[model samples]
Each structure stands twice: as C-alpha cells, then as structure tokens.
Target chain A: MAKKAVQKAATPARRASDAGRAARIEGGAVVVTGICGRLGRRLARQLHRERPVIGLDRREFVGKPKDIEHHSIDVRRKKARELFRRPDIAALIHLGVMHDPRLGAEEHHTWNVIAFQKLLEYVERYQIPKLVLLSSANVYGPRPDNPQFISEDAPLLGANRFSDIRDLIELDMLAQSFFWRNPGTETVILRPAHILGTVQNAPSNYLRLKVVPTLLGFDPMMQVVHQDDVVRAVRLALRPGVRGIFNIAGPPPVALSRAVKLLGRPTLPIPHAVARAGVERLWRWHMTSFPAPELDFIRYVCMVDDRRAREVLGYGPKFDLGSTLRAVDEERWV
Target chain B: MPARTALARIGDVAADDVLPFMGRLWGGARRSVDELAVRVLGSDFEERARLLQARYAEAGGDPFGLDLETAKYAVMTCAFFHRLWFRAEVRGLENVPQGRVLLIANHSGQIPIDGAMIGTSLFLDLEPPRVIRAMVEKWSQTLPFVSTFFSRVGQVVGVPENARRLLEMGEALLVFPEGTRGISKPFTQRYQLQEFGTGFMRLAIETNTPIVPVAVVGAEEQYVNLGNLKWAARALRMPVFPVIPQVFVPFGQMPLPTKYLIHFGEPLHVQGDADEDDAVMEEKVHLVKQTIQSMINRGLKQRTSLFF
Candidate 1:
C-alpha cells in the first residue's frame, strides 16, 4: 500500500491537488480495534474507501458499515491468530482506551492495559507490520513545575495524581518497549491534548457548566484538538515510515478562566483545598461528572508540544482554541 | 472576634438588602469605568488598534481570543500608572527593535510593580506599541485569578519553551535573569545585582535574539522589605514571604508612590555555543548583569528623593 498519509482532511500541509503524491490503500486488510467508538466508526469508514477493513470489538458498532467486517469478539478473551489465519492483517489500530465512569479500578485495568497487552501479543503472533496507539495528554499530569509545552521526553506523571489513570502510563511504556524490542514492527504512540468533539467533550462539558467551579488560585493552560484533527493525526500515524511517540496538541492555549468566559459561562472560584475536599465528597456520593482527581487538570498546565506530529506526520491542526470554543458554544446552544 | 462583629452588623441590617446595595454600587461603578475607558480611548484609538493588529500577525496566541477591547482598557489603565502614578521616565525607546529582542532587566522589590511599569513604558512610550509578553515566575502560575489575569494579558510561565515560542514569533520578551533572587532580595540590598541565571543567555544564543539590558529605579522604595521569613515560605509553598511593617498597619499595605526611571541599554547581540560549559556561559551572562547594574547605579545617582 503506497499511501501518503493525510492527517487532517483540510490540512494546509497537504493541498488538494497534491493528493496524487500519496496513494490510498490498495490491498491488504486494516484491523481497527474498538470499532464501537465514535472515532473508530469514522476511522473505519475513512479507511474502508480504499481496501478491506476488519473491526474487532466486544459489541457490534452502531451503524455498522457494509465495507468493513465487524468481528464481535473481546480481543483479550479470544485469539486473533484464528481471524488472521490467512495472515493479511496489515495493521492494528487500538482506539479502545475508554474512560467509562461506571467501571471500577479493576475493570478499567482489564479493559485498558490488559487488553492492550493482549493485542500486542496478537500483533507479534500475527506479524502486523504497523501499529497505532492513541494516548491522552493527561498522561503527562498537570503540575506546577511542568514546562510550557511539555516535550514527549517528559515523564508520564499521571500516577502522581489519579490512581485510576495509572494504566495509561503503563500502556504507553508497554507500547514504547514493544517498539524498541521489535525491529520489524513500526509503532506510533500519539499523546493528544484534550479531544473536544462529539462524545469526547469532557473539557467542553466542564467549560459549558453554569457557575463552573475552578480552583481559586490556579488556572491551567488548555490545549484542545477537534475530533476531526485527531482522526487525521491517526491517519498520518498509520502511514508508512512514521514512527516514535508524538505530542498531538493544537496551538494557542487559553487559560481555563478565559475559556469559560469565551463560552459565556461564569466561574465559581473555590480555594484549592476546599475544592479538593468538596470534589472528593461529590465523587463519594457519585454526584460529580468525573472523578475527584479531575480537579488537578484544571489546577495546572497539561499542554503538550505537537511539533513532532506536525514535523514527522505533517499533522497541522485546522481548528485552534478560539474556533474550537465557538464550535463548543454553538453546540451547547443548539 | 471580627466574625462575630460582622455577623452582628449583618443582623442589624437585613443581609439581602445590604448585599443588593453593595452589588449594585460595585457593578455600576465597574461598568461606567470600563465604558469611560473605552470612550476615552476615543475615535482614532480603534484605527490605531487595527493597524497594530497587522504587526502581531505572526504572534502565536489566540488571535480571536485576545480581547483587544479589554487589552486597550488595560493599556490605558497601565498608561495612567506610567504617567500619573509612577511618573515614569523611559529612555532609549529607539534602542528596542521592531522585531524579536530579549529585554533583560534588574528585578526589584518583593512586589513586581517594576515589571508592570516597564510593560507600561513599552506600551505607552514606544512606537508601534509592542505587547511584550513578560515571562512570569513558576510559583505565580499556581495562584488562581492571578495566573488567568497574567495569561489573558499575554504573560506566560517563565520556561524555555514559552520564551522560545514568543521570541520565535518575533515577540519582545521581558525577562529578569535574577528571577526570584533579584525580585525578592531584602531592601538593604537594593540596586545590587544578584547572580544572573545563564538560561536567558543560552536562550539568547539559541534563538539569535538581541539582548536589551534595562534598569529600573524607585521600585525598591515601594515596599520596605525588612527581611524574608524562610520558614513561612517553606510552609506556604510560596517563593518568598517578605516581612514589611506596613502590612500590619491599617490601609498601609499598598506600595508607596515612588517615581521610576527606566533606561534601555544598547541591544547586545551575543553569538556562541549555548551548549558550552556553565563557566563559559557565566562569563557571557555576567556582561548582561553588569550592564543592568551600571544603568541602575546611574539612575540612582540622578534620583532626588524616594517619593515626591
């Protein structure tokens, strides 16, 4: 498959006329894990236009595509060697790191880390040449000492705040270690900033809330990317000759207070200690939208430098902070 | 004891009634002042702003989100401080280049009134009116409204990446290489230069930016920082806790009005390996520190009194 990766549909890097330079998928099958996800659905559809795609997940995807084969099997419990018995699976795209609040700590581990390890085992057994793993920028926990644009070299510090997201850090290490160990396989780990579009709009939800409670003395810098851009980045990562970890954050980071003001929402300032205590209680009562540890994100800067993604994958974000905020505002109003 | 007294006072007057009155009074004054500022900026101000926008075209901040209407009001407010409050006199406006340059100044006083005055001078005194992004201390980023206020006004955390980005975007960056040591030094040590951190020098080399040495006087006389309480700083996780007698007095916490004099030295273009030894870099950084110190000494020699 001689595919020149188009990270975003409207990337200024790749003009419409130059589309001839990068070829689309011609032969071989593209295996997409967690096909039920909104991202997975779009990715499968986009990839399906070129060649055959096999989507593996536990439940059937909503609005299942006719061009793709939907395999309803839990990758962890089942053997993928049977499915790839003929051995034509070109790549495995894992988009299954679900932040479902209902899942307990143990369930999250099984769903995230264990499932990822199981998939890696299958990749080696099945000889999948390309692998793409999606990780969140939150893995680089927001801290007072964090650099302005945290490089990919920065340590995974999420375990310092929330025990729940510790698996994300472990998953990144596993992927990186696998990349180093295996000489044949090409692994791309994308640590994207806050994803705000469709279902993955946690930041938007928090920003849109009336009388949003913010840590009184802290306002973290926010770097968000549109869902379409994230999809585009994954496409570029899936392209041949692109490897190694990359930070995928869109530019013009806005302060949390400014984001709320842009959304026409008022903020309720609470002292850090008091807010932490209140959020802990809210989490205990199951009255909060997210876990208590979510407060730390708003309290410090978790911005990532996405220069590598732009340089290596030619992934330039189409939507900046202001445009993204306007989109969020319109979405909320409607 | 004050809590009981406040409750008794609230009990005497209906809480709801007093709250509304206070809110109405405050809101009315704030609205009129902002409106008055907008009006005072007058007709040609908008035109000038539109012209200024084109200059910052390459600047990598939120272009839609800058709120220049608010920034204008802020610049006007700072202009007042620059003209009336401090009676600041700035020299060598021509020394500052139109494009990227690093303004290295001697940091002074426990409070950062000096940095504000320098910013005000650049905005009001210079042609093209560059919106210089002041690199802020790391500890300040942890504070709530302060960080937001700083960022909205185009301030960023004092890190290599932030400075590099701003400079790369051809922004005029203001940095105090002395950092906390320079800003929080005791009153007795006023005007004396501290050991300059070589990071700025390294950054200067890396980005190929011209270094503009600045000296600010009279800020040291703002608040009498008798000394710093080290234990309190450690406990509070704050960088410094300066013990000033005025802090205990009623309505005396504000810095005393001190006339400020800012001098901009020649743009020193340094070229060397940023990866060289710290000792080698210190030799280069020492020149910048010395330049600021001499300027401060000259300004102090010309000063007549602490406050008018």
Candidate 2:
C-alpha cells in the first residue's frame, strides 16, 4: 500500500486564535507540589486564575477544587522525569517536603535539604523555565537588639536549631537559583516572614499555635505576611524573567502585645527568654516526637526587610498585622 | 612655719611690678645686647642670640599650660569634615533632656557620622555640656580609630548587657534600634522603620529610663547604594554586598556632605512603678516606637529638599 500524502494545512484564523490562547495557557501552566497544605492551596487557587494548575500531593484528590487539576504522587518517592511526563509544565512551585517543625537536624537535613537538592537536580535536568521556592525569615537568627528593619542583606547568623535548618535550605535555594540562572533558567526565591491565614481540614497547626498566640498579646514579636500577599508574589514570579530572592513581609512589625490589644484580648507579657525556654522545653518533651518538629514553628522574632519585594517585585501587602489577625480571628477562610 | 610664711609672702609679690626694676638693672641689654653678643662671641653668635631672644619672647607671650598634643588631636579629628562646608540645621534640640537621657535615632550611612555630629552639637551648643555614650554595634569595635575613639568617648557596644550597664550608671545612651539593617538597607527603602528589636524596651523598662526619640533627615541621601557586589561579599565574609557610591571614590573616602537636620521628639516616659506589669511595659514600648516613627515621617515630610 502507498503511503498516504499528508498535506500541511495552514490553521484557520479562529483555530489560530484558539491555539494562541492554548499556547498562553500552556506557557503559564504551573506544577505545584504539596497543594493540599494550607499555603499550597492558597497558591494553587491564586495561580489557577491566571494559568492551568496541576497540583501534585501524596494524598489523592477525591474531587478537585475549582480550576485546579490534581495528581497523587509522593515527590520524595517518585522521580521527577516520571512524574512530569507531560512536558508542558512552564513553571514549578516546589511546596512539597515534610515541613515538620518537630523533626531533628538530621531528619530536617534528610527531608528538607536532601529532598530539596534532589528536586533542584530534577528542575535543572528538565530545563524548567522558572522555579519559585519559598523560604522563611528564620534564616536570620534572633537577636535582642536586632534592627527594627531587616533587609535581604541582613546577617544570616543561624543562631538557633530551627534557624540552622532554614539557613541550610536558603543556601541550597541560592545555589540552585545561581546554577539555573547561569544556564539561562530563571529562579525566584521568596523569604516570607511568617505566613498567616487559614486552611481547612488541617489542625490549627503552625499559624494557630505559634503565630496566633503571639499576635494575641503573647510576649513574642513577629512579622507577618497575609496569605493574599504571599500568593500574589508567587503569581508575579510565574511571569518569565523575574529572579532574585525577595523578602515578602507585611508593613513594618507589630508587637504581640499590640496585636492582642487590637484583638480585644488580654495579653500576658512574660520575658522573651523565659517564653522561648518554655516553648523549647515543651517541644523537647512532646512536640518533636512527631514526624515534624513543633518548636520550629514557634519562633516569634523572625523579621525581614521587604524592600526588594517593594522595589523589584512590585509587592505591597494587602493586610497589615492587625488586619491579618482579624481575618484569622473571624475564621474568614473557614 | 617660717619657710611657709616666706613662700606665701613671695607668692603675693607681683611679678609685673618686679619685672620693670629688674630689667633696668639687667640693662646689659643696654650694653647693646646685640653689640655685646657680637663682641663676646663674634658676628655668627649674634644671630644665634637674636634667634634665642625671639624664641624666649614667643614662649613668654602665652604662658597658659595647654596640652598641645591633646588639643592637636582634637582639632585634627574635628577637621575631618572641615574640607567640606557643613551646614547643620538641628531642630527640636529642646526635646533632648539635659541630663541622663536616652537618645534613640535610626542608624544610616556606611559610618555613623550622624551620631558623632549630634554629640558634637550637644557639647558645643548646649549649656552645661553633657556627654553622650552611643550604643554601637559589636562589629564597629573592629574598625581602627572608630573602636578606640568610641571607647575613649564612652561609646558602648549595643549588647543588652552593655546597654543595661550604661543605663544603671545613669549615663546618657544613644541606640539605633534598626542596627546594621537600617543603615545598610538598599537605597530603595529609605526612611521606612525596621522591626524595632525589643532591647531598647527591655532596657527602658529595666532601668525605668525615659527615651527621647530622634528623627534624622538628610542622612539617607549621603551615600546612595548604586549597586551591590554579591560575589565580593561572599569572598570577604561580609554580610551585604559592598555598596558602590559616588561619594566613596578616588581620594578621601568620605560620604557626601549632605545637609543634616536632627529632629528630637518629646520624651516617652514609661509610667507606672518600676515593677509595673509586663503588659503595661510592652504597651509603653510600642507607644514609644510609634511616636518615634511618627516624628520621623513628619520630619521627612517637612523637609523642603534633601539637597538643601
């Protein structure tokens, strides 16, 4: 039998427009690992509005949320090549890994650092155009007389155990970003101060125990970023060519005492050192026995200067510390 | 007793009254002082005698005992900015307490010359001069003249222990709550308040001291951060990328002589007894921070031009 001649036909104008729209969607498609988590969900929802979103989590999605497509896969166990077989992933927001604050240094190194390294290698091998990695302000250790404003250039002293973990992760991210940038792939790192907002199904986890208590007139002071701001920054990062680490924090910083006052709650002002010691003791006794370390979530003084975000990423916080707390108290998300 | 009496009587004798009579009797200078020297030791020796007489007269002209070494050093250091005409217009100096007040200002510029200028203004302009001990960063202690001079002038490292020690001693202390971060922030984020560390509050509460918030304008524009060299920072173990600026180039690595206005706000008194409740103390600290930030915002707003 003779081979059938396949004539190359020009796409119709209407079809061309459809293809163009499809191409844009494909270009903006983002693969978010760990979309089941609070932060991951928020990011997924935010990014889905602008692009096609594929959420990969270890747990299967019985029914997917609006606009988000889901896949069941453990990032640690699966190979990236096998996982991203579709080849149309324009960006990857790696939000996976067991971020258990209760984990020890060794466990954290294995789960966060070691797993992150493997992910970076995958990102590089796949030649992903953009990667947005979320970091925390914990990289900058606590100091009593720390400057009221911490810029990106502020010292990364990694004083405590948790800070050390964050510091290692930040270094890995930076190294990865540099590696990709050198090869023409763009990477954006966001060091959000303290993530605050609501999530469903999950227990009142890090935000409730660590952040909410402090904001409600506890002894500690913390800088916060609203969920909206965090999501918005991530969305902006999805646009091609945005690179560099930006500190995404709220407007200024509020004392836990002040936040409590605003919340119409009575505050107890124990000495910072005493409070920290108590929390550390509690973690040692019970919290760390879990898969994740609880004390890692309780750090109260993680602050950073978000000048770079304001200047470069065009990021301004929609909610300050006061508003963020009010939303939480009202259970806005739930 | 007799020797004491004789010494007292001699002290009472006027040297001026004795000098005229003694000069006439010693009128060998009437033996033509120059002529006598020339005849006794030849013409060459006369020139030497003339030089000696001129030196003796110059030494006798001002007999006040002034330690020239210390005076010279002071003048030299004071003249650091002498090459550039400094036009400092300080406002709200009255807000500064006369004795033992804590001066809290934002830290900026590569080197904290604003603190030095404020100290100098206090000593020179205020009556009954007061000394200022700035609570500086520990890293500053490594710099050559800065560490020694700061030590000599009673500048303490801004550690909690040092701050407590200074407050307990009833000395005026200057603290920049923003520390290195405030001064070193990229030029893009100017005049924004950083997260005020709690040390100032803890110190104030512990010592029951009042804080005088200071707003310094015109310092931010002094040395703009044109760019940051990240690789160099990593290589050198430096915290931030080294800032490149127009002022820090070629000869005389000095910041531009930007006009400075140090505005002082009213003192914030942490009320209640020394043993006030912790919540009350924290409230006071927050109020003070807000007050200072308000003052700074106002000052920045009121300025006609950073250039002027």
Candidate 3:
C-alpha cells in the first residue's frame, strides 16, 4: 500500500522513467501466479515473511496475509501488464497452469498457454532475474517400456494417450524455449512426481475417494511428493544460480497397491478394459472426474529420478512415505 | 416380504458368522501348507529368504517392486524343478564374485525355464544366496500377470537404464544377450551359439562390472523347437514363435525332465570405452561368447545321460 501510495503521489514524468528504476533499487518482490491455489497459498505464507510477495490470480486469496499484495485479475488482462510494468518483480513463479480435464479446450489453452506467453514476454521485457515454472513429471508419460528411473532429458510424451495433458506439455516446452532465448533470466522448470497432499490434483483426489478404484493385476511403481516438499523445491529454485529442469521425487518409489494400502482405503479393482469403458461412460455422465486415458498411470511406470534435484537444487523430501501418502486426508472437509 | 426377510437374515448370517469361520479355515489351511512347504524345502529356504530380505532392506525391500515375500515362493517353486524335476548339476559355484557382476548366459528352452533354473541355482547353491535379476523382454511387460509376476520375482524390463541402475545398486544382473534368437533356435541349431548382442558387454564396460560366462548344457534338449513361424510371431506381436510339437502333446506342455548341467566360468574383467566401435566391442563380446561355448561343450562332454 505504501509503495502504491508513493507512486500515486509522484509526478507523471518522475514515475514514467524513474519509478521502475528506483523501485528496483531495493530487493524486488516475488510475483506468484495462481496464489489462490492451496499449494500456492502455502508457498506464499512461507515466502511472504522473508521478502515481499505479490499474488496474481483471477480468484480471491481467502484468508490472505496482511503484508502480501493480492491482485484478483486474470493473468492475460491489461491490469496484469500494469503489475509487470513496475519492474520490481525479481522472480516470477508460474503455478497457474490450468490442467482441469473437464475444461473446454479453448479456455484451457487460452489460460495455460496464452497467459503464460504474456507472462514470458513480461519477464523478458522487464528482465526478471528468475523464472520458475511448476511443470510436472507427467510430461514423461507412463509407458510399458519406460526405464524404472527416468532422467530430466526424457522426452515429453504425456500427451500420447491422454490429450488433456497437452497444455501442460506445451507450457513446459514454452518455458524451455524461454530459458534458452533469454539467458539472463535464471529459468527453472520443476517436474515433481504425483503430488499427494491437500492440493486438489488427480492423485490426491483419487486417493481421497471413499473406495479407490484400481486396475486389477496392475500395480505400477509410483513416486509421490508431498505438497510442502514441492513448496520447498519451488523456494530453492527461486534462489539465484539455481537453474535447470529438476525432477522432484518425495521418497523411494512404492507400488500403486502399496500406496493405496498406506492410505488404508478399500479398493475396488476392475479389469483394465472394463474400467476404461466404465470410466469413459461415467466421465461422459459427469459422474466421475477421471478420464479413461488417465488409467494408464495406474497401469504403467511413470516415475522419475530426482538425482538432479537432490544434487543441484539441494532439495530433499522431508516427508516420509507414510506421511506423504496420508497427506491427502488432511483438511478434507475444506 | 416374508421371502425378503428370510434372504436378508441369511445374508446377515453369512456376513457375521460364516465369513469369519471361512476366513479362519482358510488361514489354518494356508498355515499348514506353509509348514508343509517349509518341511519339504527345508529350513534353509526360509533362512536364505531372510538373508535376501536383509540384502534388499536398504531399498525398503526393492525399488523395482521385488516383494521378497512373493519372490521367495517363486524361488521355492523353482527349487523343486532344480532339485527334483531336472536334477540340475551346478558346476563352478564359487566362480561368481560378490558385489555387482553380470552373468552372461546362453538362453535356451522354448520357455525361459533355463533362466529360472539359473536363478534358483544361484539362490539355493551359492553361499550368502545371491538373487539373480534378469532382464525380461519389453513386450512381456505388456502382458498382465506376466509383467506383475516378473516384477515380483525380480525380473526387470530389458532396458539399458534399468540394467545400469541395478548394477550401480551393487546387485547381480543376469543377461541373456542372445535374446530371442538363441532362446528360439531350431533343434538343428542346438549347441551352436547364436549371435550374442553387444549390449551386455557395453554395459559391463561402462559400469566396470565383471562378466561371468554361464553355460547351461541340457536346456537345448528340454524342448525341441523345430522352427520359428515368423508370420505367426509377427501377427501375434510376439518376439518369436517357436514351433514345438511337444506343446501339442497332452503332457508335453511341460518341459521334458532332461538332466541339466550348468557351468559358471570365472569372472572376466573387460575394460574399454562403453561407446567404443562395435567391431572393438564385438571382439570383447566374442571372447566372452567363445568362453561360454567352450564351457557348454565341456559340460556336455562330461554329462553321462540326458535324463539321468
């Protein structure tokens, strides 16, 4: 509020040329997109105490902290451009990539890709020193022949079976190109494994089901990171000199059955063919959120090797396997 | 209403009393079977299983989904074939070195019973009981129970990365470099070494792992593969379609109980660039292949009978 007040009080000429330059003299604020998300909110709460944080999201940040600045505006809107013009954003952490499979392709594409393109342009123009995009390990699709541990250099093949993941892959590719084209910005792309926490992701929601459905006779090894661990990884990426693609895995890989057992859920195991057709029908009826293609995850190995994240980013998962699996149950009523 | 009440009462009785009674009965039966298995296989089997569990404790049992509990039963089942069915004579048991090593073996038998026998021999015969992790064909991973069974029994997908990771973890890896060609060879081509792939040699050199040439003498006689039906194999999306008349016979689905002789040659240390020219790597691979062939020949010469 004080910063905005000062800008308003300044003369137009002084603010036009010198306002951005002078504000950058102090350590710049970190702009966090999708701050309204559960993971993003957790990250904001952790980061705001140390440095200034500006939240950018279309939705309101409920129970927002006093010090953090919240902007309830669409990322592609002109008002969001006004925030970038301040030139005080030292880093931009993109966590706003929409991945709702139910959303129409046009809206999904516009929000995830087009909005990201606008943000990249701002970062390039403003010369933001750091850019971190929260990509996912799902970009490397589950395959029958995938090596047990996939490295960072693996191709983005998540869209082969599940077309819903196309936007996320596009965003990751866009960030990669941005990293190459703009060398000045320390662009970091984090590809964390299936995150199991209060965050409303597919893995978490699936585990939260009253009777978790699984493919019979298919128990692929899975790696699930905790939400807090992912938040920590994002914070580490925000650190200067930390730049590259890092796969964040929480703990040692466990079988899908083992994970379900850890959650203590009674599972309804269906054969792959029957489950696929059933899920397709249920999805069409809006009775189930899981698309049929997503069943491949439970059927094949899509785990990643987090050696790069551990060696370079110095990030380790503090949550053990048991707690990580149980996190989906936290704050369930909310 | 009277019929509905009677059915609901029967359901309630089944859920409340009959289920628990049945569960207890099943539990008792399973316990007796376990005891019978232990008595038949001897207490040494359980001891070896415990030792293996300790060995894999670091990875919390296994990263590749190797449930030692499931694997021990598999090993126990194979132990029967190794001990009684084929009565495999394992030679040069001490030749296997501790720590990460590659067992380059000849792949034979219409099925992979030879690999299972090798694994069983290593587990039952070798001191400290090393579990051999072999690489299964990637296509097998597409099969339902086969894939799960392979994973539980410590067989991984045949990928370079999986092989490298296994070696790095200081586990013994079994590589049948001949792949489908050697395993599905026609009866006329028996005893002749099929073209070995250079992948195992490259992996051995890259990981600085010692290569142990393993020779199984009697597997070729277990099931006589007349020829490979290429058209059928392609149509079925199978690696190879070996035409074995035994498969058509009433009891011939089971491999003939041919007396087996396995020879483990001394570990060979091959050092070179992993990415060296194929010709250079082939020389090293050829050296290993020739050693295996000679060992197989010697074992064949020493064996007195095919089904003794």
Better of 1 and 2 by TM-score: 1
Q: A1-334, model 2: which lDDT tens digit per residue?
A: 0001001112354445434433543456788877877778777766777678988787765446767888776566665456554567777787764555554667767766666776676777776666777766666655434543456666565445435356355543554445434433456777787666674311223334343333112233457667777888888766644566778887555544445566666544343356566666765688433222223223223467676788778888888657776554445452
TM-score for model 2?
A: 0.48
Ranking by DockQ: 3, 1, 2
| CAPRI quality level assigned to candidate 1 from its DockQ score | acceptable
lDDT of 1 by residue, B1-308 (tens): 99999988887686768878989999999999777655544335556566556554445544213445556667777766666677788898899998999999988878777887787677666777767688777777677777766766777777777788788878889998888898888989989988888899999999999999999998888788889999999999888888889878886787777898889999999999989999999999988888888889988988888775
Model 1's lDDT to the true fold? 0.77
The sequence of per-residue lDDT tens digits that candidate 2 reaches over residues B1-308 is 99999987776664666666778768856778556434433344324334423532354311111122322244235424421334566677777775567888877765677787666555444444444667766665434345434443545556565566556655568888777778776677777767666567767766878889888777777778755677988998887774755644674366667777777788887655546666766676667778777877887788787757
Model 3 stretches astray by more than 4 angstroms: A1-27, A332-334, B1-42
TM-score of model 1 relative to the true fold? 0.82
Question: In candidate 1, which residue ranges exceed 4 Å CA deviation?
Answer: A1-26, A204-220, A250-278, A318-334, B1-67, B228-243, B246-252, B304-308
Backbone clashes, each candidate: 5, 15, 0
Per-residue lDDT of B119 in model 2: 66
Residues A1-334, candidate 3: write the lDDT tens digits: 1123233335665444344443442356999999999999999999998889999999999999999999999888889888987856788999998888899778888889999999999889888878999999999998998999899888899998888788889999999888778756768899999998999999999999999898888888899999999999998887755677899999888988888988899999898899999999999999988888999999999989998889879999999999999999987423
lDDT of each residue in B1-308, candidate 3, tens digit only: 99999999999999999999999999999999888776546669889989889978865658899988999889888988888889888899899998999999998887888999999988888998988999987877777778888898889998899999999988899988888788889999998999999999999999999999999988999999999999999999887888899878899988999999988999999988999999998999999999999998888888888898
Q: After superposition, how far is residue B284 of candidate 1 from its true place, in Å?
A: 0.6
Tell me candidate 3's TM-score on chain B.
0.86
Comparing 1 with 3 on TM-score, the higher-scoring candidate is 3
